[model samples]
Each structure stands twice: as structure tokens, then as C-alpha cells.
Target chain A: MISVSKLLCGLAAAGDGLRYDDPSGPDQITEQRQRKPVVVWNTTKGCNLYCEHCYAGAETEPATGELSTAEGKRLINELAAFGVPVVLFSGGEPLVRDDVTELVGHAADRGIRPVLSTNGTLLTRERARDLRDAGLAYAGVSVDGLPETNDAFRGEEGAFDAAVDGIEACLDAGLKTGLRYTVTERTVDDMPGVIDLLHDVGVDRFCFYHLDYGGRGAAVQDADLTPAARRRVVRRLCDLTREYHADGAEIETLLVGNYADAAFLVEYAREELGATAARRVYEYLRRNGGDPAGERVADIDYRGDVHLTQFWQGYALSNVRDRPFGRIWTDTANPLLSRLRTREDHLSGKCADCCYRDVCRGGSPLRALAVHGDPFAPDPQCYLTDAERQRDVPPADGNGVSEPAD
Target chain B: MADMRERTRVERSSGDGREWETFVRQDPDSSLRHVGSVTAGSEGVAYEQAATLFGDAADIWLCPAEDMCRYAERPLCDRIEDAADA
Candidate 1:
């Protein structure tokens, strides 16, 4: 049901996109569905931080750049005009640009809600207040996991505290805030600890994103979670959800994985969830990774070109300035972001048969095509022998636990 | 929340008009059309001149007839196939 709603909004936005597969019907009529009120606009092509699994694109070195204030403002203005009620700000670090507040403030003034996606190390109380005063509504801090796990994935010391501080600052400013972790082979083990940290910081609503590789991480994808590794992570996440829930805490976990178990888990996830819970679930799937091409997390090659949300060194977006990836959204020929809309894997190569294909967003078509030479191929780990599976603690599912509702 | 389409926005250019003259990428594969100014004639002649120019480009099969005028004005005109025969 959660997946269906997301598909509805996405498909409705496609405007008659469903007709592509329904050959027997009229050629150009789109069924009316709920429209997606928000869109993520990647303003900066470069990032300042270079974590092990970074996806910001072109973080090969300590480079710092952003979409010029001029064009950035243009984007915000256009988004407001397009009637996209919400715009998300992301980058190597959106704060790195001196003019980020300018765009965020502008969007907010125009009655367009603005959300900031940041690694969270650079945010200070003063900065947070400024953001709030400028009308920033929410902030998403990426803290991955606890110290040991987080440092490895974030590739920076003290990022843990920086992220916490960033969240605290936003909270201080009365902005609704949240945290997210890209569950991977390395950090999935620390799911329980990560949840505890979220509670400590007063975040009742948090999102967990399964690790995926598209642009930058494609360079180092083998380090990506194998299926066996992913199962281990999922089981633990499941247990943690149970542990927290049994204790009478209200905890919600948005699972983002290969969807290897998604078909079965969808009903399980909604056993007794609400609208907020449902929305949390939808966002988990919406923002998670996988490229248009099958590029693994470790297969990222920054020097190469890949279509990114923004024009990064790699990750191309066809025509960044004029078209919104017409090829990817050109009716229904695309199998990447618009996959959920068409309900078929037009470009997933051979992945359509896998039950998880529908759930995992086919991971990333570019990544799969890059690492496995077939976007439709099951994640390389899925086909391995059972003997290859691990006999350790399962991954955290976040549903087993519940934090006391604040 | 209000509907997403209530706001209106205009894309802004960063530089002078000369910037476009220097930056407009002539996609080598674009269709050619004729939109350039046509010669002024009698009272009803203005629209007729423009219409005639439009007709010249419209006769082409695959080429973008609207673009024919731009190329025709440049030194590249010699290279443009008028399709007058085709």
C-alpha cells in the first residue's frame, strides 16, 4: 500500500505515463492520481566531504563549489512557479556555499517549504538560527551510525558530534528535524546503536536508507553490502525494532534495501502503522539510492561522467539546464527514477522477474549495468550459495523497536 | 498547503545579451526553420513576405524549417539546402 501511493504520485506526475504499457487503451490519456507536491533540486555539483560511500559526485579532492547564486536563485524561483510546494537542498554540503541561505530563504518567502539535506557537521547554532529566521522549515542530518561505524562510512573524525550538533542547532531553532543513515554492510551492524543515538537527540521521526551506489560510490562498490551481508543487517534491524517496541517505545524503521524481502515485509511494516508512519515509509523508498545505470556503490569513478541529480563530474543528467531528463521521464521508456510509476522495468534489463525488483527500485540501473553488466541482474550476492550466507546477528529493521512518543 | 502551481517564476540570465550570442550551442542536429525578417513590400506585403519565408522552410521534409532563416543569414547559408527542388 505504501509503495502504491508513492507510485500513484510519481505516475500522476508523469502525465499519462501509464499508457506506455497498456497498449490496448488510448494512446495518450493519463489517469488522474495524486500529484507529488515536492521535488529535490540538486543545486551544487560538488561536495566538501569525501566519505567512503559519498554520492555527492566530484569529491575526489577537497574542492568547494556550488550552483552559482544567480542560477540557484533561478532554480528556487522556477520551482515556486512550477507549483512544487517543497524544495530540498543538497550538496557535497549545501552550507558550503555562502549563498545557500539566499536560495533557501527565497523559496521559503514564496511559500515554498524548503528542506535541507546535510551531513550536519558544519551547522552551528548561529547558522541554524539564521536558517530558521530565513524560513528554513526542516533539516535532515546524516549520522550513519555510532562512532566506529560512522567514522568509517563518513570518512571524517568527529562527524558524529558534528551531526548531533547540527541536529541540536536545528531543534533549537524550532525547526522540525530528522536524521538518516544509509544502511550498508559496515553500518547496518550498528543499527541499534544508531537508533539509541537518535532517541538521545530527541528525534522521534527518523529515516533509514538502505545503502545504494550510483555516482561517487560507484568507484568503491565491492565494499558495498553483499546479499548475505544485507540479510545479516536486516535481521538485526528487525530484532532491534522488536526490542524497542516490546519495551513500549514508539519506534518506526523505514527499510531501504534490495527489497529482497520487501513484498512480504510491506504488510508486516504496516501491521499497525499510521499516516505519518506510512509517509515515513514512502520517503525511505523515494530518497534511497541506485542509479539509472547499474553502478555499484564501490564502482564510482569520479573522473568519469555519470548523470547525477546535479551535473557532477560523473552521473550525467542528459541536459541539466533545459530538460528534466526527458529520456528518463520521456513518457515511459525510462527504467530509473520513473520505474515505480510505470510498474514495469522498461530499462532494468533482466531484473523484472525478481520480486525484490519492484521493491528495491531495481537498486540502480546504471550501477547494476556498470558492476554486473546487466541492470536487471539480481544483486550479485543474491545468486550465491546458501553456504555463503553469514551466521551472525541480523540487520536492524527499526520496526521492532518503539521510542516513547514525545 | 496551497496547490503547487500558484507561483509563477521566470528564468533569469546571468550575463549580457552578448552572452547568448557567444553561448547558444548550435546543436548540430537541430531542425532548420526560417524566422528571420523578410523584406517589406506593399500594405499587405509585410505578412505576405513573412509567410513566404515560412513556406520556404515548411516545404522541407526532415529539416526544422523555422531554423532556415538563421543559417541563411550567416555565411553558412551556402551550405544550407533550401529544399526548393526536393
Candidate 2:
């Protein structure tokens, strides 16, 4: 996930752009970017609402072999011991689990920053307080669109009300709260309304997700936005983010499941805000290391199977119940794992030649593999123009001197 | 688990060398605690970096590291270090 608000407003306001690492002051050690991956634990496959494009293919009933509370706690210990930075509790609805609060407390007590990702139907006022008391750092509630649309998407009549209320509950309970919105062609027209709703609800952050073809999402892959439509929405998000930042609204904006947005943001800035501004944006994006799925992000399903990313359903790296997460993550003997660590050499098609490949890393491997059989194939969703994809000529530097292509 | 605040303390040198300190409050009524710091060239970037790095907070405030003031004798790390050094 790239924080559009953070990348643009954070650096743009500071008048500084290139630093990538955590700042070390006098007497502080320069922090090395650790290989520790942010782990998302899918607590259960049980969900109350069934959305059309549910990525987890969640059912109303819990899946078999879902981690026991004891198993879940043990995994938290293993992750903590492994130096995992964040453990996001995700599920068909994480709140559906009875031990979720206990698990959140366990993670926080172990110094793992605990976050919750849920459909929000189950997050009641008291439940929100319970979670906060359990030391959850943040709660991300999925709100797909307006009341009617969101309800239809969630496949429940009052899901929108329940979700919006859940967001309110989290906020009222003093927990840091944000909205997670997945955009499809159907809901694309409602993007601006969604932003307005975010403001109205006083959400602290908004994560706009590009559709990923996983689980039930595969069924709706045709509903995924066109490259042009995706670009239009991104441009709108950038404009809205800048407007909100300029007005000093306290909100964070981000795009998930896609890194092309980052590249497009830089390109957009170059055309609208001039070269200096574009360079600043480019430097921030570069530092963020776009599309850090298999490398920096990983997922442990309810059954303790570790996958390359949360969206990837198959190809388990190792089961946390069988081995420590740290060991499994560091074991590069798995050919795919090894390739993911340094995939630059393996990226094919326009991705291998595009100047912005470093910024996008061939976009989502899961998406690529879904559209084409090859995980390393060029991302079909890349919105860059033919000229941009060709890499025949170097992008013009402000000074007009072209450096040799790598 | 290692202290994330301590773990996240490393700095970057690629762009602007300026650094900012991040403070977060878990609740509207809670006092702010020093969460972590981010290295950015500008104040706007610092604030955004602080938010991204510490998004769990209900409220976040960022100031250039150079602008922050502290009592050298009354450091929280000293207490933490005493246990470590003991």
C-alpha cells in the first residue's frame, strides 16, 4: 500500500523529497530496513455478509481447521519472536471470532502493532471499546460505496448502515479508524461520493483498493476497471487528496493492490505541477518501494498456511503451525520465494523495459498470473502509454541531459 | 518483541536529510506519546510520514527534530536502559 496523502502531502509540505529510511538523529542508530514482513492473519473464513467480489470467498460458517485460540496465540508469539512489525487480524470478519480481542491483546502485549480488517457488520460499540482496550492500534472497515450500492455489494440490506455504524463505533471508542474501499467499474462513479462520505464520517484514513482477482473476485474480474478508467479515478484521487491536504483536513489517503497509481501520480505531477514537483514525487515513490507484495507483505490463512500475499490463495510457503514464520519467510529454497526477493531480472514484456518498472515491479504478480499464466508477465492493468512502456528514450531530466539507460 | 519505536528509529539519506519527530495520541483525551520518527526534507512530508508510520494513533503531531526540546536529565530511555544494562 502506498499512502497517497503521505507521499504527496508529507513530503510536498516539507519541501524535502529523497530520504527513504526512518530518520536517525544524533545518538540514534541508522535504522536498517529489516526483511521482517508485515503478516496478515486471516483469523477465520466466517463472515456475516457475502459481497459479490469477496476475496476470501468467505462463507457464513467458519471453515474447518481454522486456528484454535491457543494456536492463534502461539502464532502471535512466534511472530513477535520473529520481529514481525505488524500483525493485521483479518477474516471473513475478524469480529466473528470470540477470541479476537484476546488475540489483539496478545499481539499488542508482544509489541506487535495489531490492526483489524473486517467487513464491520460485527463491530458494535462495546466491541469497539473491547478491541481498543485489547490494544488494537487501528481498525479498517470496508465500505464499498453509498448506502444502497454498498448494501447490494455486501449482499445484505442494511450492511451499509452497519458498516458506517461500525466506523462510527471505532471512532467513538477512541480507536484510530479508517475506511477500506474497493473500487470496481460499477462503483467507479461513486468514488467522489465515497470521499465525501469519508469526510462526513470523520475517518482518519481512507484506503482505495483496486480489485484483485482472488476468490469470488475471480468471478467479477470482468468488472475490473479499464486502464483508462483506472487512470481517471487515480487522477481524481490525487486531486481530492491535494485539496483535502491543502485545506488541512486530517486524513490519510492510500491506494492498495496496485502500484501503477504511484507511477501515474509522478507522471501526473510532471504534466501539471512541473518537473521539480514530479522529481519530488518520484523520489518518495522510489523510497516507498512500490508493490511490496511478496517481499514485504505476507499472509497466514486461518489454517496457518503462509502465502506469498494475502490475495494469493494457493502456493503455501510454509505453515506457521509447522514452522516459525521467520524461518519460513527466510527460507529462499522455494523457487518462487527466491524469485520474488529479486524479481527485476525475471520481469518480462513491457515491465522488463519500462523505466518505471522499479517503481511498479511489474504490478501485482497475482493479477498478472490471473490474467496470463505467468506470474512474471507484464501487468495487464499497467496504464502507461506505449511510448512510456517502450523505454526507447530516457525520460527528460530538468537539465535536458539524458542519462544512459540501464 | 523489540520496541517498535526503537526498531523504527533508523534514518534515510537518499533525499532531504531533514528529520521529524512523531507523537501520537491513542484517544482524543489521551496525552501524546513519542511513537517514532521519520526522515523527510519538508514539514509536510514529515507529518505525512509520521502518519503513515504511526497510523494507529487517533491524533498525530510532527515537528522537525531540530525544533523539539527535551530535558537531558529526565529521559525515559534511561530507565529502559537501566533494566537493559543491569
Fnat for each model = 0.00, 0.00
Query: Per-residue CA lDDT of candidate 1, range A1-406, in tens?
Result: 0222222222333353323222111111122211322345555545556777666543523232233555455544544554545566766677776777877888887666777888888899988999988988778788877987787677777878878888888888887777667776677667777778777877754566654554456666666677667656655665566566557664545443345434323323333332233234434433332222221111101111113232122222222233322222232322232333443444344455443343455543334445565444555534323321221112223442332221
Model 2 lDDT tens row, A332-393: 65446677678888888878878887778889887887787677788777888876555422
Question: Which regions of candidate 2 are displaced past 4 Å?
Answer: A15-34, A390-406, B1-86
TM-score result, candidate 1: 0.59
- Measured against the true structure, the TM-scores of the candidates, in listed sequence, are 0.59, 0.77
What's the C-alpha lDDT at position B28 in model 1? 42
> Candidate 2 on B1-86: residue-level lDDT in tens?
86444221212122114656566786798888654345567778766645543444688787665565433332212222224211
Task: Give TM-scores of the second chain, every candidate.
Answer: 0.22, 0.59
lDDT of 1 by residue, B1-86 (tens): 86554322222222101111001112346454222122122324434423322222333222221232221111111211322311
Worst 10 residues of 1 chain A by lDDT: A296-305
Return the lDDT, model 2, position A371.
82
